[model samples]
Target chain A: MNVGELIERLNRIGALRYEDWRAWVIEESGNSNPTREDVNAAALAWLKDKADGSIWLDPEEEQMLGEFLENVVPKHFDGSVVDALAFLERYGPEIASKDVADLKTYLNSPTGLAMIEKFNGHTGEQIGEMSHFFQQESNQDLSGYQVLRELEGPESVGNTSGSLLAAVTGIMPQQPDTAASAAPAPEAAHAQSAPPALMA
Target chain B: MQELPLAQTHELELIVDRRNRAVLLHRGPELEDYLWAQFDPEHNGLTLFTEKGEPRNLGLAIPKSFSDKLARASTLKLISVSERLHAGRPRQISLLQTTEAFS
Candidate 1:
């Protein structure tokens, strides 16, 4: 089925939350819901179950489920789930049964949380696409660089410079010094302390 | 150059210090640092840098009131680099932008 139908099915199955959807999908499909590795399997099984005269997730329902799974679920799933699954995938059995709490703690750190957040809204395929882009971008490959080069003409250059200056300075035009100081004694000291060579 | 998403409500600006080789983004003082920090610098998704080595400022400018929600809900950051020419040598710079939403 399509994404919308799949999402509707998932919602009807009371799998609106990430945890609930994951549990239901895993339990029903009997396939590990460790990562995207199991999405296709779970989806097929889910479709089969609907068709088997058991739980009925019709075409529209299946489409909803797919859309939700592909888009909304990825965007909103708690960071811990993504980290836990990734940890399991990357570190193997060492993190296979790791608790959500531990995974959460790992995800709270600057680097860990950053990665989790970055990958939160993307499927394995989307991540792969991003990775491919990065690889190509990093390689400074000719074709991509050419595209970039074409995008950087005179107008683009001026606009970029304007943007850079705005970003760095917080976009406020520098104001002339006008306000009276609470204490003027420090002014002489400040000037005297300035780099002597520059003053000279 | 990506438009500053927050520009409608906030008077946001980008500043570059060619001498210091640093780039900065400024929104009015009412917004919190954490809110601004949400903008990531790595992805080039938000901000674009010039090839001539200068920073570009990009972002949304929402009212100061929404600062708390932004910090809690999103990962927004200055992202991307674009290169351009300055005089003869290639100048390379970074971009910073804002993202804001209307109530």
Candidate 2:
């Protein structure tokens, strides 16, 4: 799908990540990118579409996200968010509150936080794997959940909270002889559904 | 501690719910809103905060009755109670897992 279509889908599913957008833009425009400007403008237009649009991120929510990103990105996951100010300032002025609130709410919601907490518990090798995965051209646009799904492959995808926890917990440093096609651990295989995606 | 009014209360919700599972969401965020559950299970609890290094007045304590379900995530239920019933007070939160998560 084209970028606009991609954005619409991401927005609808509440899976949009600023890092993904910036990565896409940087790759397309070759630096001196206008992603933030365009995003700010689009956000203004989206808010103008409806004062209470569900997708906008207000300052309060932005601060929450800034804190979240401070902890997660730049290390476990690589790409963008140099500092909190640069992180928070990307949106346009006249930004309505809480359009962003919805985003932050969903982003930090319990399940998301739970899964993120699992990712946070990764070993140095796991961290390396995650960083490498995000930096890949094919993986840049995928959400953290999507990356996990891919790593786990379709066979072991876990849907429930227990299995989700197991799904994440089940991830370990694969033995060199471990086949990528081999099934996930018994706990992972026990989970039947997929959990939600997280923002970056 | 003496009881006092909280600056922000009753702000979290479970946006998605299955019988045994639910997704936790932080709602009506203020500039101070941010969750620091990173050191949890080690620090012994996941705390949401407003100001950095300060967790005052941001009560997201889960009710013990429901917190047990969470211990069962290994067993695989969602570990949820009713968000409305449990999240109404800062003094507690409740996550009841039923071994039916992902159902």
Candidate 3:
């Protein structure tokens, strides 16, 4: 079933079996129908929506969606996956969550399957294809993010710099300050505050 | 200005040094003292560097407001990271307040 049909089915029954959702996704986003590329694009778009807060997500649901996109969804694809978790972790608050639950609901449906198929292939045989595709996209996104940062007005530069977390990941904790290394006392003090809470 | 209960399952504590215009994350005592990452006010950028000065990119869990605030402050210290839970699961409202009051 295509996303459209799947939506229709969902509306009629108010719910769907996993099998039904999968079948519809397979039919709609199959090798011959929507094509793996189309499915992949849709999946990325959906993820972008999730990242930018264009979709509805509760906190738990948001956490789960971040995990699925970063871990499970990448397992199905072949190329190096963009770190969806990192993006969400850093910029989650900036991206506005939708009032409706449609995005979360759709992700749990066959539409998700169609997106995963971009990398996993028909039977999970295709690998690297989706990963490589995403890797390229991530590179482009990073470049764009950098360009945007450079273009920001002086008044907004600080906020944009803070947004580095959203555009990139893997390097956190390291402040760009060389002087921080010279001052260990504040660092220790910060650590001191955490233990009591962490221990609890 | 607000006191928030820390999350039991939180992996890291986010702190900001407004005097230095930096952001840092405090891991548990079991971790190294220098494992924290800070935000660079000059560059308005945060890059993860280990205690050994090795550079890499690591993921962090911080509310968008916290990061945004880092750019505006000179010495705000993050006292504790807190969250409110729903259905036994944590919500997204993780709070990172400074030691000094914000007027």
Candidate 4:
């Protein structure tokens, strides 16, 4: 999309909050905050390049663009490109893979391609839940439970304690009489003591 | 007792002689994490290793019970247990000639 059109869309999404769109422009371009005139000039240049089809995206650039359109735009922009780009810097990695895959699939569908101009939408909470479920299933294990049991002793501390600690505690109880047991007793003088008389 | 950095992944080699009833445990850098996970019991998703270097991915749901047993066990005794568990069994090659003869 042309820069002006892109910016206008972002503005509609509530991306452009201030009277001057300079902050949003700078963020989108990854450039230092520029003056209004500078932003206008950059925006015009970006638009011109797009119109001429001179903007060739490398693999990294393409991936970034795909991520931004599928994740950043739908989630952050009320409809605004400005707010979306800003949010992208922070929450980009947290984007769900499934959302991106779904977006690609939809975009390739005949119906989707027919109305490609109206394809902007968010996957919302469903994507988040899917990601959480996948992560949980992959990492489910018993080591933590075992560790907890060991730490809390064999009294069935339930699943809350670390297994390593439980095992250690179960194996190594403190010796209460270690000091007393270590002390040597003095030998009595056997010869000095008189022998007891035998009973009739 | 010194911790190795996660950047390095090491492979471990274990030898098992089922006929001789012997097991040898070998450790290198990569196997450190695996060993720690197995013995620690607190490490979730840890896999147990057989003397033949094959992983027994049996998810023992109750690690606490296993840890209790391990706690009372000496290092040598634990090694012996690991060896016995991993010892190879005779494979049945044919109906007429049983592999139990080799065992």
Best by lDDT: 3
**Steric collisions counted per model:** 82, 22, 22, 18
Model 1 residue A20 lDDT?
38
Evaluate fnat for each of the predicted models and list the values in order: 0.01, 0.00, 0.00, 0.00
DockQ of each: 0.04, 0.02, 0.03, 0.02
Which one wins by TM-score: 1 or 3? 1
Q: Each prediction's Cα lDDT score? A: 0.30, 0.30, 0.31, 0.28
* Residue-wise C-alpha lDDT for candidate 2, range B6-61, written one tens digit per residue: 21332322111122222332222222333222212221223333325354332333
Best by DockQ: 1
lDDT of each residue in A9-28, candidate 2, tens digit only: 44454335433344444444
Q: Could you tell me which 10 consecutive residues in candidate 1 chain A have the lowest summed lDDT?
A: A191-200
Error of 1 at A126 (Å): 16
How well is each residue in A1-200 modelled by candidate 1, as lDDT tens digits? 32233334344554322233344555556854244335434544444455444445455544543443343334445323333323223232233344432443444567554444444423222211222243222211111111122221111111222343222212323311221111111111011111111100
Candidate 1 regions exceeding 4 Å error are: A1-9, A15-18, A25-33, A52-200, B1-35, B38-103
Q: Model 4: what is its DockQ?
A: 0.02
**Candidate ordering by TM-score (highest first):** 2, 1, 3, 4
The C-alpha local distance difference test score for the whole of candidate 4 amounts to: 0.28
